[model samples]
Target: MGTATHDGAESTAGDEELVVSANARFFRALGDPTRIAIIQLLLARPHTVSELINELDVPQSRVSNHLACLRWCRFVETERKGRQVLYSISDPRIRDLLHLATRMAGDNLEHLAASQRTGPDWL
Candidate 1:
């Protein structure tokens, strides 16, 4: 028997459920400021955890946790070079998505801040 997907499309229920679950996990991975900073740093080039800790000026444990989350989401991947493991954005599309999102938010940043300060009524 056929089954319904998340969007009510006809498909294998198991496949669609997995896709939706993965997408949620992916968003959760990007949901944090720390992870976003990590992504920003990785945008230029891959970096070791130590380098990330230095550049972001965050605790090593915090950086490690965020890296783990990003890795689980497949937003970033790692490669071992010698003794150090370097982390980098997993997909080309991730960079593009971040760039576009930053550009859009940059234009509205002041307004967004103002809105937050005022209340949800403005929203």
Candidate 2:
């Protein structure tokens, strides 16, 4: 067993801090609606920046910015094909994770929706 620190982390210096920072960066990277849309689009297939702009209907610069963020998070990868740079999902596991999250959200939303629809029997 390792020594415990006062902060409930291992005595190993910087390990916990690094983990916290990485987790924050990951969540922050995916926090934006635009970034999530970019991920969903890339999950379907690789697309050039022009293609993405057309499909997403967002401004070119905004899409590019979100693509950069996704790339930094390692969720997106790019290739220089001809004159256009194509972006695709870097990890297939991300698609699986997204699917699982969608199911989980739907499960939760079903309860919320039923509650909202019926409301309180007393009311």
Candidate 3:
């Protein structure tokens, strides 16, 4: 009975490790700029890889690479239609994050411009 209990504890530990590793990978995938752009574009609507390539104005290889990362992270989902895959954000939290990022960017830009007008030396 003790041996069985020990094995169960070890199994639980292993499951936790897997969960943490998966979470780490997900955040690491989101750290890329191209991946963030791809996610933001997808928030509007689903699009084929070719559409993303044109919209992002990036190379096909780069877009495809980022899409793969997003898919792995489970932040985006893909649907198969013949040879093409349509991609879109799978999580609503991503849309909230995008809005928050936009607001932060606008606020930062305004602060930067205001500081520049006042001159850094004056402060």
Residue-pair clash count for candidate 2: 0
Q: What overall lDDT goes with each candidate model?
A: 0.85, 0.81, 0.80
What residue pairs are clashing in model 3? none
- Cα shift from native, residue 27, model 1 (Å): 1.5
Global CA lDDT of candidate 3, please?
0.80
Comparing 1 and 3 by lDDT, which wins?
Answer: 1
TM-scores, all models, native as reference:
0.74, 0.75, 0.64
User: Tens-digit lDDT track for model 3 on 10-122?
Assistant: 34566667869988776667756689889888988999999999999999999988888788778889999999889988998988876876787785866654554444355
Mark the regions of model 2 whose C-alpha exceeds 4 Å error after superposition: 1-13, 109-123
* Top-scoring candidate (lDDT): 1
C-alpha lDDT (0 to 100) for residue 109 of candidate 2 = 64
Off by over 4 Å in 1: 1-9, 12-18, 111-123
Q: Give residue 77's lDDT in candidate 3 (0 to 100).
A: 95
How much does candidate 1 score in TM-score? 0.74
| Candidate 1 vs 2: which has more TM-score | 2
Best by TM-score: 2
Model 2 — TM-score against the truth?
0.75
Q: CA lDDT of 99 in candidate 2? A: 81
Tell me the tens digit of each residue's lDDT in model 2 across 92-114: 99888878867877858667445
Error of 1 at 82 (Å): 1.3
